[model samples]
Target: MLSILDRYILKKYLGTFSLLLLLFIPIGITVHLAEKIDKILENEVPMTEVLIYLYNFTIYFANLLFPLFLFLSVIWFTSKLANNTEVVAFLSSGVSYYRFLRPYIIGATIVCAAALVFSMYLAPKASKGFNEFAFKYFNKGRSDRDQSNVYTQINDNDYIYVSYFNVTEKIGSNFTLEHFEGNKMTYKIAAGQIKFNDKDSTYTLFNYSKRKIGETNDILKTQHKLDTVFAFSMEDLTPVTYIAETLNFTELNDFIKKEKARGSSYINRYEVVRYKRWSLPVSAYILTVIAVAVSSVKRRGGMGVNLAIGISIGMVFIFFDKIFGTMAEQSSFSPFIATWFPNFVFGILAIYLLRNAKR
Candidate 1:
């Protein structure tokens, strides 16, 4: 079930979306680097380290820029269609507005799906390495790399605890493992110091002692060397304790669950980012509908007017998204809604305006 007009619109949809994202992401990175170049130079950062940090910043900025770039792409591309009278011609040729918009919807769906995959899977995986490089490369002070009270739970019933972990050195002290049986503690092992072996995905506890308070409260103690496998490896910790932007949706979800169960409040940022990663992808679809609805009306000022309004509205959406995200950290507003409220509200408004424009 397809038509020539559907194909035309699909071409425009994908062509514009891809072109804008490609163009704007580099522009964004350039602007970001230029602004920070002085600071980097003044700080006496090495050229290699500076470039690595810039790369990390650029990647994270690109992820955030996708929504705005997509919005602008739709607006400008559709304005061209309206300007050339192709839209009017389509209507005259018996193409209903919704029917004409179908290809756009399909294209938006593809973009949305791709966005989800990148944000939830690939991007996060990249972020892990990027963040580590950023920290290790640009750290001005040796003490800047220390981590505090790093605790994580690997499974529903199994837990891994590190009282004070040093991320810069990959060392943890006062480590403990407490196994649970529904609501009761069944096993407890306390270690003196833990070291992570990145190659084998295991933790080596040195000069450690343990006490097993279960089954009969039979206390067991040891010192010297203890080796064990941790549910999370060194790279996993980099995402949680170090950088919020580095984790994908699944990683964020698992991190929040772990920290929350461990009675840690520092995970609110990760929780918000988790919901945001899921919600941001559909923004492309919303922007497409809004762009078509706004531009097809043939305003008095033509394309320039439409572009200005489009950019303004897009900026407002970004502002609102940031505001709600901040409020999510400080208030009781549901983190899920806080991250996604702008997209949800704007999507509904776009539907209403699309109907009005057709009338």
Candidate 2:
């Protein structure tokens, strides 16, 4: 049922996209290595670890720049067709503009599906490994641990607050735990400082006091040092820097719900990541349409002019995405809006260009 022209265009579309990724990935790796070589040598990291880090970095970098690569590849190949007058020949043979676009749409759909899968699963795993290796081996001064004014809901009725927590030492100062029943406090424990003993898997609280609120009276007990076990652990207090990047779509949704309930300060940031996973996949289609429309017409300046325009548009798109993303992370802008704003704007532009190209 497939025609020769459809197959030809589809082949070119996918083949060029593949070739672009293959060529640029090594450049990305080399640049990254150049930036990190001094740190790697100074830290004296093992070759095995370096190899593993590079493997993970490959996945991370590819997923991060997939859209840019896709846009540029489409522009490159489509412009070549225009330069060769293949587009003119196809149109001269009575193929409608919409019909010619079908193969491109199908190709974009395939690539979009692959990108979705990568973002939801493989990229998360790679990001986790890559960031962990970076923080653990190369960047010794930086840590993934959250330390200041920590607050969270450990369970339905239990809440915790820590004024200061040192993740390296597994110690906390000015810690408070409260238990509530139907919005009424039942019991509370306040500690000047708490330390976790890894050997015994127990907590030691210094200058700790416990208060029990009864129906009639309150009973308070004070102790110099108390050793006990709690439902939570040190790991709960210290979360990774890119925790959102480590979870798949389902896990990210559940995490956002829980974090929202706990009034996390970084909820907006997590929501931005969640929305972006879906947005980037949709962008593949929009960018593909734009690329086809822009490069369909053979210009006086030929491929160079088309590529220059494509690169400028690509840069502008990235700039808009970064600005809106930062706004969502820092301000009250909805993550859903921030994540999709560039797509919405560019999608309209694609439609306009497609209309003009059709005429």
Candidate 3:
């Protein structure tokens, strides 16, 4: 059903991409191991855990740079074809530039689908393992979540606050919970300290006191210690900064919905993660078009010139992505725009370059 030219280019596209992954992933692992080996040894981390961490780190690293790798692979192989005059011969024949682009589009489709799967499921699992191991070993005494002055609305009528929370221990100090009926406060509970029991899904509050507000007077009750159930979990106090990254597509959607209801300060951060899952994969098509257009013309500067140009473009794209992503996370910038802006700008570039290549 396919022509020989299509098959040949498609084979080259996928093979080169695979080769780049194999080449770079090891270097990434080696660098990461070199940096963390001292901490790993000092912590006495198990060899099995270290191996698993590396496995997770591979997926995490690959997912983070998938688009760049794909972009470079397309440039590398297409530049080679241009250097050999194969692309020139095909275009000089009866084949149109669009016809020549067909295999690249097919290759982009394959990569896009695979990338979607990775972002939706595999990458989240790897992120959870990778970040958990880092926090447990490499970042001891430091937390990956906001741990001070945490406030959350558990429901329409219930709100909770904690002065300080310990994520590792699932404990909080200066905890308070308030219940409201319409505009009036119904009751409030305060605790000197609180600990969550994971086994029983309960909470232990030390030096607990409850105040029930009335029209005339307030009734107060006190206890040295109390074990009670609350509608909220320990995560409600202060979820990790990367919690959104560790959830799969379905879970992320659900989490965003809940966080929205709770008026979370990190909503933009979560939304950025959500939008990137789709945007990153879609960039494959735009980058592929740009790569082919950049490399299909034979130049005196040769493949090196094409690669240099490609790497520069790749670095710029990554720069735009990281800057905008950080702005969205740290400020009130629109996450949708931040996530898609790089792709949109480069898509325009792809079109312009593609027109020139056709000419």
Candidate 4:
């Protein structure tokens, strides 16, 4: 808690991290400007708008590589110290290699925990504003990406069949509600359209008809020409809160609950994303441990060589992560494995490297 060496190492790691971000952001801006100059000019977008949008989008790129940046920074700085024999000096001066690891672990713990909060508590809410701002002014807003077909469900029971739903225009078409207490259909309602009134928490149907069956092969039919209201929420269609990347953990969980009650089919993606968010943050700690361990030891190679290796490893990790996630989304792999396998593998590797660093 009070060692100067620990502080020094923490200072080095954080200082380099800050410097990398500061430098990379401006470079990112320049690159974005050069790439988007044509569209910005052609769309007659304001320079200020372009600047603002690009600034927000910069976070997207920076976040994707933040761990790599942190890891490389540790490798770069610590490797330099090792190559200069400072590590040997420390070792000679009553400091064990394991003792020197204290600062790295401490710093990594803080960073990883902070990253977890950022991804789970902050990122989506921020992205909502960021995306709106980008779309409204910078990129010219478009219709929402989520679309769904209508389904017939009694009180959102989802035991019946529905054809499709229109999000832009609040309407459900070819709706059929089937009631089955056990293995038989006790009732069925086929409606032409379902109209939703969100503010009032109700819905209206147009050109609707209902059919009922009783024991002894008795049947009853009913029809309605005018509009009628029933409790309905547009959320039943797409369940915005459970769309994985769109909502943070708390909100997503709430959405999952609501949709689960309705017997939604796509809940797996949301759960996978929630678990992955926690796993990814932990990965930052694992990567940091490996980076510091590899660099903290005195070696014949310098910072450049170690940094190159670190960056390469980090890129490969990121690639496999994306690949596995895609495969999971496509139902080619188990969601649990796809989401956390890379982190699990790398975490083991980090432990091995840290052991060697002690030797």
lDDT of each: 0.76, 0.91, 0.95, 0.71
Each model's backbone clash number: 0, 0, 0, 5
> Stretches of candidate 1 above 4 Å error?
42-55, 133-244
Estimate, for each residue in 1-359, the C-alpha lDDT of model 4 and write its tens digit. 54988889889878888898898888878986788677677778777866667765676556556787788878888898888888888888998877877888888887788777778866665556556654444455443434445332335433544466666667777766677766777777677877666666566666676667788774766566535554444655534432566687878789767756766566566667777777777777888888877777655656767877788888989997888887876674677888789898888898898887787
Candidate 1 backbone collisions, by pair:
none
Ranking by lDDT: 3, 2, 1, 4
Candidate 3, residues 1-359, lDDT tens digits: the string is 77999999999999999999999999999999999999999999999999999999999989989999999999999999999999989988999999999999999999999999999999999999999999999999989889999988899888899999987788899999999998888999999999999999999999999999989999999999999999987778887889999999999999999989887888999999999999999999999999999999898999999999999999999999999999999999999999999999999999999999999
User: For model 2, how does the per-residue alpha-carbon lDDT over 1-359 read when each residue is reduced to its tens digit?
Assistant: 66999899999989999999999989988999999999899889899989989999999989878889999999999999999999999999999999999999999999999999999988999999999999887779777777888888877889898998888888999999999997999999999999989998999999999999999999999999999999987866666658999999899999989888766778888999999899998999999999999999999999999999999999999999899999999999998999999999999999999999999
Candidate no. 2 TM-score: 0.95
In angstroms, give how far residue 81 of model 1 lies from its true place. 1.1
Candidate 1, residues 1-359, lDDT tens digits: the string is 76778778888878988887678767877886787667667777778876766666666666777888778888888888888888899888988888878888888888889888878876775566666654454444543332666565656776666677776668878777778889987667777888888788788988776666667656778879978876666644433454566666666677677667755545666678788787888888888899889987677788999999999889999998999999887777778889889988998889898999898
Provide the global lDDT of candidate 1 against the true structure.
0.76
* TM-scores of all candidate predictions against the true structure: 0.72, 0.95, 0.93, 0.82
Best by TM-score: 2
Model 3, CA-based lDDT: 0.95
Return whichever of 3 and 4 wins on lDDT. 3
TM-score of 1: 0.72
Ten-residue region with minimum lDDT total, candidate 3: 232-241
Error of 4 at 67 (Å): 1.8
